[model samples]
Target: MSEQSLFERIGGREAVEAVVGSFYEAVAGEMSLRVLYPEDLTPSREKLEYFFEQWLGGEPRYSERYGHPRLRRRHFPFVIAEHHAQLWLKHMRSALELQQIEREDFDSIWGRLESLANHMVNAHEEVPREPLPEDAWLT
Candidate 1:
């Protein structure tokens, strides 16, 4: 028989769902990261569940529903700098650890996540420009 996919080995849909839920819970406490997420997390949770299912070698439901994930493009509207990526990874790591998964499986999954998160950085820190003084306006 063919070997089961990582998704299956990791306990399939239920596990992925649990991980997504826990991950969001962790993100809630990250003040800087919170601005990147929507006020209502339901949509975020659903998209993540579907994306992980497809990415982990299960059915391609995410693609079917949303077309190509185009993850980086989708994230472009947000300012995902290195600091944001690190915060994201931090929460994700905590969530994954809570699962008590096998070490090998954890390493494999974390590696992929790290690569993806690193690729998501699209901006860098810069000082905010001060508003022009009212008197500077042309009469």
Candidate 2:
């Protein structure tokens, strides 16, 4: 039998959507990462779902709609430091945990995401700021 794609092994499109939702929930709960995402988050969630689906060997909807996934270029506007990458990975790890994915699959997916998140870092300068209120990101 042919080897199943990661998407298939992970339960396909619906699973991808669910993971994305869980991921965003984790992100929203993280003050450090929440501000990086848009206020509404719906569009970001959809885009992340498509991106993850394609990345996991499913249909390439993200590339089909958005062309090449120049992720670094796309994220240049954000102050994506190493701290941001680590926080992003933390939320993603939590999201994957909620799915009860296998160890090998989880490792594989997390490795790729860690690499991608590290590559997305564009800003090196320290983020000068004061302690933010709990709802500061909502603004």
Candidate 3:
């Protein structure tokens, strides 16, 4: 029998969207990683969910809309360092675990995300930027 595609093993578009939603929820809650997201996660979540859905083999919507991911180019403006990459992977790992996705599928997804995160690093030192106030709900 042919091996199942990662998308098939993970339950396709619906499942991937659920996982993305959960992962973003964790990101929205974290202090350090929160800044990577916009003030609202709705748009970001939609983009990622669609991206993964196409990437994992569900549909071509992402590429059709965005015309090549160009993940690094899109993320070049962000200051992702080793620590941030680790934290981002940590949350994603947790979300996959919580979804009860198979280990192999999880590893595959993590490996891609880790690679993308590593490539997203644009600066060695953190750039000076205004800090979010304690009461700020959005990063």
Candidate number with greatest TM-score:
1
What's the distance in Å from true for residue 94, model 2? 0.4
**For model 2, how does the per-residue alpha-carbon lDDT over 1-139 read when each residue is reduced to its tens digit?**
9999999998898888888899898888899888877799998888789888899999998887777776765666578889999988888887788786788998898888889999888787444333333222211
Model 3 TM? 0.80
Which pairs of residues collide in model 2? none
Residue 16 of model 1 has an lDDT of: 91
TM-score of each: 0.86, 0.85, 0.80
RMSD of 1: 9.6
Q: Write the per-residue lDDT of candidate 1 for residues 15-134, one digit (tens) a residue.
A: 999999999988887889988887988878888998999999999878887777777766666778899999899988988787868889889999999999998887863423343231
**What is the C-alpha lDDT profile of model 3 across 27-133, one tens digit per residue?**
98998989777798897888888788878877777777777676665655567778888888888878777776877778888888788877777667544445433
lDDT of 3 at 88: 82
lDDT for 66 in candidate 1 is 74
Candidate 1 residue pairs in backbone clash = none
Candidate ranking under lDDT, highest first, comes to 1, 2, 3
Tell me how many residue pairs clash in candidate 1: 0
Off by over 4 Å in 3: 1-4, 125-139
Q: Residue 69 deviation, candidate 3, in Å?
A: 0.4
